[model samples]
Target: MRSRRAGRTTGPHLRPRLRRHPRPRRSRGTGTRTRTRTRPHTAVLTAVLLLLAGPAGCSGPGARPPADGSAPDAGSRSPSAATGGEDGAGHWRPKPGTPWQWQLSGRVDTSVDVPVYDIDGFENDAETVDRLHADGRKVICYINAGAWEDFRPDRDDFPRAVRGRGNGWPGERWLDIRRTAVLRPLMARRMDMCRDKGFDAVEPDLMDGYLNRTGFPLTARHQLAYNRMLAELAHERGLAVGLKNDLPQIPELVGSFDFAVNEECAEFGECAALTPFVEQDKAVFHAEYALDPDDYCAESERLRLSSLRKKLSLDAWRRPCP
Candidate 1:
């Protein structure tokens, strides 16, 4: 649940994308249905995935969660196989324990000594990314991949059929990611902005909405397909991509992504969920607002996650794990 709301994970809002216009009338009557234990799949979709991302294996045998009923989600498909050859060449792959500054709100304090920065994709422009690169730092462009925010410039581009139930956050609705035929072009354009702006990596947030009450028939397979499509888009453009907070899919996706970005994994006692990224020697860039440095830093350091503590506003001020 991306949100027990009034709690973790309602991040920064996008800057207004267009002049104030009447919101397109939205259909608000979609029914929420109980999802099945297994996601439905067709041969064509599987063939498309195998063609886009080659069959890549898990980073390690131990990285797979146990075969018991306790870890049934472990059977999900991995997006890594498609990340082979030149797909991984042009992007920045952060080290397992790199220090980072995540400030999606307020004027960025570029003087922070961290080697990486995560900032809003819409609010930040090409010059902002260039400045970070000038200081010998890698930059990650943060975008809402699963939800649509009214404030975004391209807000009107979302079709009524694609919008789903509200995500507790005001002016935001989860998009039906299963509609890749429609979403790919739009998301590709957003990634094009990232590439044109000189971003080194991308953090696509709200990807786990399929696990929530998003008034859609989205299955685990749909999420896997959409996420791999995002990865391929980023890779094709020569930009690094992170699998944001879809912890349940880590074992299947760690190889497709260069890193992972998570919120409140520490607060929820779920930091261990990111072990697959670390096992593959990839970074787990984690943040917590509810816990103090004293409460989570030791465990974060032990997990080798590059952890930080910042308010939910995601401003410039921060307390990094020692």
Candidate 2:
């Protein structure tokens, strides 16, 4: 798992920190479903909207397991895999109050009985996505969009000129978002991989690089442009896009993104800032590392945010708001 946007420098890097001590993969077991209010009306609205928006992107053909500790080979795949997204118009739009599980570390425990699952885009293969879809779950692909990691298969594709200072994570550096001409194709490839893997949505991490001490003269305008570009990429691939922790710009970006992914908003007294998304009927998938579910479940329920208590490592364990 990656760090929170607010505590980027201090939040733990779950994978890099445990590279040598990887936890053993656990077999999929039946997950206990959290009791949530069924919103039959909302589901109907979403389905109607999807139909009006045209067909969803096609799932990638066949299940080719990704290599151990690396991304799948994009070179051997057909260019059509990256070309399904026509005009960035029709895409999945998850509504407010949707329950979800975010697991980015260790092997994904797919038994979680929620209607949604968010997992790393590179770590898991097409087979995992197929299984999730088989179980009638919407899968969100997690990608490090605002930063460059040395461990990715396409690491060398990023030029040194675009790499900035470390974002408090090991072997990870912030990318210069202003360099769109250079970064556009790279990010498109990542989104392409997500679409090709049959993901329904995407949660791009570290989107608020401008607010951090990145070694670049980034402005809020630059951040907005880059984030909007990311949303377009996902939509072009016919996948839902999320605004990850850039709360201050929610009012401006709510229309561009399909949903929002937040970290520790309740702890920071910023949960209200995400209301624009909910008010627009978009989901806000949130998590807290330090606070117990008891500390904020009431507020979470009151606000109708999809909130949960998760360990800093962000493994399978989770305590959802009741």
Candidate 3:
């Protein structure tokens, strides 16, 4: 999420750690489940929801159908809790409307009272994760899953052959995700670190590297394969995984991931693209670095998003929607 290198200009990746100048203050910026509900109640609720649903299902309450007009899979809605159904493997599934604190820079201020915390996986250790657990919070380990950062401790682990063009941010380059033979073991170790450190989940950044100019002839199919592999690796360690900023593939990936971490969808008029996750009763941890709460909170709430107003640095400071 950051580079210790001096004078690196921030790039427009999903979350930029630093910018040459602060963005002008204004509006704009950017899962799956098991069934927990009783059948009869679910039936009545489903029927009522369908009766109320309209073509503009993107901005309102209740279940949102896919563009093909198919209903979401059945699951008990737990809007009041951040926790979701635990699969047999004991992976943590965060539900829609879950509150969270995402801090990727500086010493994480664990003082924030929230149900979940997303912190740099390499920066924080097992002790920090234990503290969060003691305080009744789910800790998410953040790592660069699809990109190679020059500053990371395991920078040398990545072979130069897999490195692609710079991913906007200094000292970071997109990884050739298609080469799973090399990446699988490398990313597996990162996921193992999250599980070993007691993290409940993983927030893998740059998941949409295929969509960017990575100097690799990556396609959507390549992205899907790599992202699914990431999810499998996390789940293998009994840790939940999030799809970070890969909107185009949500319909296909919402089932593989336990939740999602997004940035600035509201600003780019792309929030509607995220409805698939919400429809599945999964958490959508969203942040807006530029938009005020008043600008998007209402729609965010209706769509069951866990919305926050954060600085580009993504420090401990946050303005959570009430």
Expressed as tens digits, the lDDT of each residue in 1-322 for candidate 2 is 3633322433235522111122232222222111010111334324533533422111112222222422232212121121112223667777677778888777788777677788888887899999988877789999988888887889999999999987545577889999999999999999999999999989988787776666999887999999999998888888998898776667679899988998776654567667778777788888875565566776776676787766656777676665
TM-score of each: 0.74, 0.75, 0.78
Clashes of each: 6, 1, 5
Clashes (candidate 1): 6
The most accurate candidate by TM-score is 3
Candidate numbers sorted by TM-score from highest down: 3, 2, 1
Badly placed stretches (over 4 Å) of model 1 are 1-88
- Taking the tens digit of each residue's C-alpha lDDT, what string does model 1 give over 243-320? 987656766788899999876665544566677777777888887655556676667767777776665456676666
Summarize candidate 3's per-residue lDDT along 205-315 as a digit string, tens digits. Answer: 777765566789988799999999999999988899999876667767989999998876665455666777788788999887656566777788877788777766666
lDDT of 2: 0.69
TM-score of 2: 0.75
Candidate 2 stretches with Cα past 4 Å from truth are: 1-12, 15-89
The residue pairs that clash in candidate 2, if any, are 85-236
Shift of residue 242 alpha carbon in model 3, Å = 0.4
